[model samples]
Structures are given as structure tokens and as C-alpha cells.
Target: MSRPHVATIKEMAKFHTDSRYLEHLHKISQDGDNDDPQSGDFGLGYDCPVVEGIYDYATAVGGATLTAPQCLLDKRGEVAIDWSGGWHHPYHPVVGTGDLCGTGLGKGTSLWMTQGWVKVNLWMTQGWLGVDPMAGDPMCSFNMTPVRRAQCLQHALCHVLSCCVSVLSFHPVSLCWSY
Candidate 1:
């Protein structure tokens, strides 16, 4: 598949204040190494590939948020999709130093989501139904037994699918699903 349009560091910095985290993220992008120790301690372990495309993912979402408003305003039927963009947990005014605490710094998925939600709400208020299929809460059962963990994931997936189907059944618009 073709790559989505990614946002630049300058564009992303507008939503954040910590220059240090942003610098580190920039380095990661330049180096293309998610396990870069210089990325501080918030690295997503050694086996996860989530960190590899984190910057691009964030950028894609940011791009979507930036243009979604205009798209909806110009033409009420415009459909914008950013499949890799939906972090949903990170917050703003990140509080940390050398190593980001909480949900880690530069993970502005939540920031993008917040902005996107506002635009989406605008669309919905204007009688448009925006279908965002971002299901399966990642923090289901991190400490459960192996078998139980699998069950929890399965259950979460089912719940997410059910919710998506229910929403689709009601509102028929652009469908964006993120697994």
C-alpha cells in the first residue's frame, strides 16, 4: 500500500512545548531506529515494531486533523482516512525531563484524536456520521495468564467489532478502521 502523508516536526511542535522530546523523536526518525537508546527510556521494548513508525504515524494523524476540517467545510461529503493515526492515550503539557514519564513524550496520538474529535463533532452536528473504527483497547489485561490474556484480547476484539458494526449500521459515512 502507498504511504500516507506525514506531518513535519515543525507542524507537530505547534501542539507541544517540550523541545527535548521532539528533538529525540526527530533523531529517531532520522536514524530509523526505534530502539535508539537516545530515544530515552520510553522505548517500546525490543520486540515491538510500534516505535519504528511512530513518528510517521503521528504525522499522518496530524495531517489528517489539519486537513479534515477544511475537507468537511469545503465539501460536506469528503472522506478522509488516516489508518495509522490513533494513539488516543497520550496527553498534552507532557510532564517529564530526560526520560518521559506517564505515557511517554512525543506520543501525541491523544492530541491528534482530541483535535480530530472536534472536527468530527462538527461534521456530526451538521448531520454527518463519521465512522472511526478504533477498537480493542490495548490496556486490557497486561498481567493476565497467557491463556487468559489471549481470551481477554479475543473478547476485546469482539467488543470492538460489535461497537463498530453497531455504529456503521446507524451511520453510513467514511469507514476508518485501525487494528
Candidate 2:
């Protein structure tokens, strides 16, 4: 397994934010104070905390998530592993509505499922924050059982992190996102 190119701070910013957020992050990093009064306006100090070196952390995570798609786009591999997958949910996209998943045409990841996840189990493994029967509420997700829970969590992670693609057709041959 080779490492893909790490995305530049500029690139990550282009995809997710602009200069304002980056500037705020740098200011927080320098002062080591994440308790800015207007932090909520910047979407920080909420679910995402404003930590020291948050700029670096955010870039690293973005790079890691971009790795799988980069590898596929570069034709470096058919299967790319991105442990950072499944956590960052996009604002809006398609999935459950697509005919590919519900028509029993092919298996898919819950990454695209916005709602009604509890209804679909045949095409994909029960997955993500609320979809997995074992995984409970979004705020405090994951199971309570001991050994079996661990195994199940691991299984779900594997499904989340790995994306398999058919080189011939360029489709997701497995539970993964392909370029």
C-alpha cells in the first residue's frame, strides 16, 4: 500500500472553506484559546472544537479522506483504504434514492443514505451512526455488548474504510467509493 499525495492546505480550503475559517484557525492556534465568542459563527466550538493546531489537524484529516479517491483517479490501485472514511458526512448528496442500491442492482455504502437507513439492509450491511441495528443513537453511537460489539464495530469499519472498484467498468465492486 503506497501513500497518496497529501492535499495542500489551499486545496483542502478550496473544497471545504475559504480564508476566513483558515485565519480563525491560525489565530486560535497562536493564542491557544478556542473559546472565541464568535466561534459558532465560524462553525467551530460546536461539534467541532477549536483546538490548538486545528488547522493542521483539519488538513491532515482532509488529506487522509482524499487518499482513496486520489489513488483510484491515479490508477494506482483498485482498492484504496482510507480509515478516515464514514465520519465526515457531506452536506447533501444522492444515495438511497438511486436505483442502484434499492433495486437490488448492487451493494452500496450508507455514506449516501440520508434517512430511512433502518429500512434497507439487504443491499448493504446495516451501517453508520444510526443505521446499524447494533449502533445506537447518533450522539452516543456504537453498541454496548463486549466481544461481539467489538467484532461488529470492526466489521463496520472495514466496510467504511475500504472501497473496491472494478477496473473494467469503473464501478464500486465492493463497499467503497471509487473515482
Candidate 3:
């Protein structure tokens, strides 16, 4: 089947509060950058569009609810995967609106304001499977060779697929692994 159309910036803003934050995101999506690490406008590299796609997919699958845990419970047999997620940060509406010279200003400090919040736990609470083939290995270190890291991820993903087959018990499944 054809993939669903990705969401626009306007659609994503609906899931968030804080007009300032929304404006920052809109600028990143449109003008390409606003220079604040704590704001969504900071990152608009070539991969920004891809990141937007991932967010759109997650929201479309009903993963943005405030009560995601309860929602999962209500749909016991259904399965959803958000492979590109797991950044584990909260959405702060007023993050970049305060004093410009404040301590830790512009250093991505606001990014941590929502750490460990409910939204960050969506995957864990909703029964999403996490597989780390590099578990117990340091292949993810920046000093590690790119080839080594790629190999590790590939092995891990293969292992994940095998585990899914066994755990799924012959049930049909749909998976999206966005990067």
C-alpha cells in the first residue's frame, strides 16, 4: 500500500502549546533556522524533513495523547512502532521566551526541562519493543569506526526481526523503521 502523506508543520503545531515554541518550529520548517538550541528552530540540516516525517507518523498513529498508557491499554491487541522516536524530552512551550542572558541560555538547557516526562515514556509504557544489538558493546562511541557502528545496527535489527516473529505468534504486523 502507498504510504500516508506526511504531516505539515501546521498539523504538528496542533499537538503542542506555546505560540513561541510553535513559531520557532515553523521557522525551522520554513526559513531553516533560528539559532536557539533549546528551540526547534536550531536544527534544520538536510535531515530536518525526514525528522518531520517521523514525528508526523508517530502522531498519526495516536501516540501523542496525554494518556498514551491508558490508550494502549484500551487497545490490547493492536501494535504500533515508532522507530525514529525515543529522544525522551518534554515539549516546553515557554522555554525560549525568558531572559536572553539567563544562565544556560541558548545552550539547549530548556531541552531538558521535560526530561522523564510522560511523553518521553510513550514507547516504554505502550509496549514498544527496544532492541540493542550493540548491548554490552561500545560500538556507539564517537571514536568507533562508522563501518563498525553500521554493522552493529544491522545485526541488532536482524535480531529484532527474529524476536518479533517469535513474539508475534503468527499475527500479521506492520512496522515502520524511520531513521
Candidate 4:
């Protein structure tokens, strides 16, 4: 059987109206607040840890001794944990509108960065690298303005280059692709 394209609002509206769709909507709504670190993002949050755990478990079942924390790096760049789950809200020892900066990474101070806020952080963290998204840096991805998105994407792409410097020798004719 052929699989259908990804679902979208327009496509769903064209389908036969039925309670089945309504049921799915209801399921999503009920599970929406699951960003609660306590609840584990309605179970999707287990993806990282479970993948790591299984990979090692297969080799040993009980023979693998690696702890889940030591084995996996979640979006936060650390061991997967309930608290580290990106909530996109809640100020972590800092002031901001939401949690997890513009990059969607958790650590590095979680919070939503307004446009004006972005400008500020850029100014402050100019000398320092990796300022918190809440720092109001224009270069920081946390800033939600369209202009900042470009700037943030630029900075992120540049960082990507630096990160791959070691591997650059492997692929002499590298090509960059973006969406």
C-alpha cells in the first residue's frame, strides 16, 4: 500500500468529516500541556534516552554498563532528563518570555527573546561567545524578529562551519544545503 503525504490542515478539511479526526484533535489537546517536564512531553520526550538505552542494551541486555545519562546527549547537550525537556517557558535563573532560546536548545538559559531583547544581548555578549538567547543579542537566535532570524541563522551556519572544520579535509568539495 502507498503511504499518503504528510497531513496538513487543508488536506484534513477536505477529508470526510468524521469523529475520528475530532478524536485525534482531542487527543492532541489533552496531551498539549505535556511539555511539563514531569510528564515527559506526552512520552515523545523519551526518544533520545530510549534510543541510547536500546542501542547499548542490545549489545549486552544486562551486559552494557553505560548509564543513560552518559550515553545520550539531549537537545540540552547533556544527559537526557525529565527536567531538561524543552518547555519553551519558565525562566531559569534569568528573565525571559518563554523557555528554550531561539535555537530550540534547552541549556544556555531558556527563554523567549523579543526583538529588542535580542539587540541588547548582542551588544553585551559581543566579546563573549554563546550568550544566552535572553541576552537580547541581535545575533542570538532567540530573538523572534524576522530580521533577527536571518542574523541568527547566519550565526548558526557560521558556527556549523567551525564545528565541521576538523572534518573539512575529508570532503574537499563540500556543499551546503538549507531549507
Best-fitting candidate, scored by lDDT: 2
TM-score of each: 0.42, 0.52, 0.32, 0.19
Native-referenced Cα lDDT, model 4 = 0.29
lDDT of 3 by residue, 100-126 (tens): 333332333332323423223323222
Those runs of model 4 whose alpha carbons end farther than 4 Å from true positions after fitting are 1-45, 51-111, 116-152, 155-179
Q: What's model 3's TM-score? A: 0.32
Across 1-179, the per-residue lDDT of candidate 1 in tens digits comes to 22334668787777655666667665676678765765545444443334565666667766655554444455533343333233323443542211233334454322232344444322222111123222232333233333443343344343221111111212112222211
The Cα local distance difference test for each model comes to: 0.41, 0.49, 0.34, 0.29
Candidate 2: clashing pairs of residues = 163-176
Q: What C-alpha lDDT, on a 0 to 100 scale, does residue 117 get in candidate 3? A: 38
Best-matching candidate per TM-score = 2
For model 1, the superposed segments whose C-alpha errors exceed 4 Å read 1-5, 38-50, 76-81, 93-179
Ranking by TM-score: 2, 1, 3, 4
Number of clashes recorded per candidate: 0, 1, 0, 12
Overall local distance difference test of candidate 1: 0.41
Q: Write the per-residue lDDT of candidate 4 for residues 46-82, one digit (tens) a residue.
A: 5322232332222231111112222332222222221
Residue runs of model 2 more than 4 Å from their true location after superposition: 86-89, 92-138, 141-179
Candidate 2, 1-179: lDDT as tens digits: 75646668677666555577667776787788867886687777555777778766666666765776667567775455555444343422234332343433244433343343345443223232222223232343444333454454454545433332211111121212220
